[model samples]
Target: MNSRAAQLQAFDRLLTIMDELREQCPWDKKQTMQTLRHLTIEETYELGDAILDNDLEEIKKELGDVLLHIVFYAKIGSEAKSFDIADVANEICKKLIHRHPHIYGDVKVKDEADVKRNWENIKLREGKKSVLEGVPKSLPALVKANRIQEKVAGVGFDWEEPHQVFEKLREELAEFQQEVKSNHKERMEAEFGDVLFSMINYARFLDINPENALERTNKKFMERFQYVERKAKDIGKSLQEMTLAEMDVFWEEAKTMDKRF
Candidate 1:
């Protein structure tokens, strides 16, 4: 690991490189925040994938990509005479110190939950109309649902026990089943969303990240299916030409090859 001085020096190097790129690179000079927004989002998702895979080298590279985007945006801001990198960094630093009153001030906190409650209260005191205001409108539905639940829970709007959440999930499931039986497409969609929201809440109560769990299942399914595809090809058959039993054999084989399943 680098020393503090070394880390600062490396960051300074990055800033210098960014300045040069903005001056000399036509593409960089032509870019605006609006034009870079989608690319930044793609880089963020790449970083997320690296983290999920637990690939340290890939994670380090992705972090650099994200950091470059930050610096790029800061450079643009400086050009517009709005705010520079220092202003952006200092603002977050101030916000952090303000939020963590237990550390920066004499505020008392008994546990993680107390800290969370205090954080929400501080946001409200800071003129936030609602705790939910912190959640971004552009976040994916699953992530947005989780953030909404967490924000409300931070302010004491939550079930008291895991069993209560489980019961709520069961109730949602029953409602969804009723909607399914009625075969009302719109009602079923609404009920199904409620079921998913309830399930995410239940997952939270169980100390699980519903997004990560679902993503892991998705990755596992893709790997197993790909294995089945490979096996079918090796047997001189396409997937459409293979019987269900034949594919199931390869799927089981893939499962046995990896203990994670």
Candidate 2:
């Protein structure tokens, strides 16, 4: 069979297995959307980690896990006579087609930036009261900041240049320093938030995703830390017993070895 047909057949098999599990597996039958919410979030992070690690096999497996969650949710909805898998697929298909007017319609887009601008304009035209309305409240703070900036920038509200964003970041940092010196707890917290927000804006100005940047740092730290642990074990010293100087040596070595970053 052709690739598309093979994919469809695989999807059909997954759906069939889901149906059997719902009917015959006690654990699967007992799952509710509320219970699965955290699992879905965890699966998403696993997929992200896989992507960041460049582990295609892990990414494929994690994607299947996420897809199973989607199908499971659809199955639950079907049981309740709310909606089915086809409805879920149709909704996203319609959304994709609607959003890509430049692809499916005669809308002219000069570049990726223009496409983003058009997307925001189309979303506004779709009756959304605010550009920020679609941002999930549960999103990580850095990601939320990035999304908020992008949404506003879509409508022409943004810094003219990266230097302008950098200046703002510096200003916020100065204010945060002042708050720290004054020991005003509440004001310090607010200023700290402003500093982070400005940093996120600077990240956006440079066409960098703050969340992905942070995640990459997180992974790098974990890898270096594991190296430290392994080195300490090899030398017959526990991590807790290792000196700061010794750990720093291993950390610097890790930084040198991790040339890809």
Candidate 3:
């Protein structure tokens, strides 16, 4: 681990490199925040995958990538005479101090929920029109739904019990089933979305991140299916040539292998 002084020196080195690149490197020089936006998003997902895999080395590398993107954006901001890295860093520092009254002020909190309630209330006092105002409009539906539930919950707008959330989920499922029976395509779609929203809320009550859980299942399925494909190829058979039973055998093997690993 680096000392605090060493850490600050390393960050200064990064800023120097960024400045050189922005001045001398043609690609870096031509880059704007808008031009780097999609790349930043891709790097973020890479970091997410690293975190999910619990790969410390990969996580460290991804963090550097993300930090570089931050520096790049800050450089662009400085060039435009808008703001620089210090301004960006200070703004968040101020926000954190303001929001955490329990830590920075005389406010007392009994639990994590109390802290959250204070944070949301502070945001409102900071001139936010609604609790949901901070949730990005461009977030994926599943992630957005979770954020919406969380923000409202922070302000005490939530079910009193986990079982109540489960009951709502069940009700939504019943409505979805009714829509399916009616065979109205549009209504069924709407009902299906409601079911998903309810499920996300229920997952929140269970302390599970629905996005991470779903992505883990997706990765698991891909690995197992790929294992099945490899087994079929070893026997000189394509997946299309393998019967369901044959694939199931490899799938079972993959499951066993996963358990061992």
Candidate 4:
């Protein structure tokens, strides 16, 4: 039965540790946002891996690592007389209160979709000229495509139905195939991108998150591949020596397993 105050105290202790590191550790003191940028991205991916693996303990540890980075940045900002962690927290707090007007104010939202629509509208009112303004340009292409589609959808630009999106996906795929036949690498890449974008739109129409959907497929592929490896080992054969027919046996077996979900 931990209280909110106890959690705040724990966070304060973490902030204190970050401050000590910044003051006494040469490496920590010498670091800047530019230096830590890649490390932050790596930590974020590690956190994503932990989440996908459904490892709660690992997620907690990775979250602490990310939190430490937040405090570390805040400590550096404090030294430069810019801002502190409190200001960062307060800013987000105010933003959440403003965004979730259904809870904080008298605004009514019918459902989660309505909440999302309101959130985007509020962001626009807060001075974002375009719905896509907040999506990072450096995001992975698949993720960026999904976010871009979602952002555009928030502003009322989207496909009417999943079936229509599916047809567009097929059209893109056909165009990509034609580009491949003509050996036009650039056009092939563009058409392939269009296919992926259309598929993401279809997923959105079906109320699915493209990122989560792809992550699930990634996990499934890993499990199935591992099954193939294990089957090969049990048969005293190496994967390199196994034929496609032999691998297909284990692949199908893996599909039959209930643990895939």
Q: How many clashing pairs per prediction, in order?
A: 0, 0, 0, 0
TM-score of each: 0.98, 0.93, 0.98, 0.89
How much is 131 displaced in model 2, in angstroms? 0.6
Candidate 4's residue-wise lDDT over 1-261, tens digit each?
A: 679999989988888788788879989989998899899999999999899889999999999889888888888788889998889999999999999999999999898878888989999999998888999989998889889888888767877778888998899999999999999889888888888888888888888988888898988899889989998999999999989998998999999884555
- Please, what is the whole-model Cα lDDT of each candidate in the order they appear? 0.96, 0.92, 0.95, 0.88
lDDT of 2 by residue, 37-83 (tens): 99999999899889988999999899999999999999999999999
lDDT of 3 by residue, 124-167 (tens): 99999999999999899999999999999999999999999999
Q: Is candidate 1 or candidate 4 better by lDDT?
A: 1
Off by over 4 Å in 1: none
Decide which is better by lDDT, 1 or 2.
Answer: 1
The digit string of per-residue lDDT tens for model 1 on 1-261 reads 999999999999999999999999999999999999999999999999999999999999999999999999999999999999999999999999999999999999999999999999999999999999999999999999999999999999999999999999899999999999999999999999999999999999999999999999999899989999998989899999988998899999999988764
By TM-score, the better pick of 2 and 4 is 2
Off by over 4 Å in 2: 259-261
> Which of candidates 2 and 4 is the stronger one according to lDDT?
2
Lowest lDDT 10-mer window, candidate 2? 252-261
Off by over 4 Å in 4: 234-236, 258-261
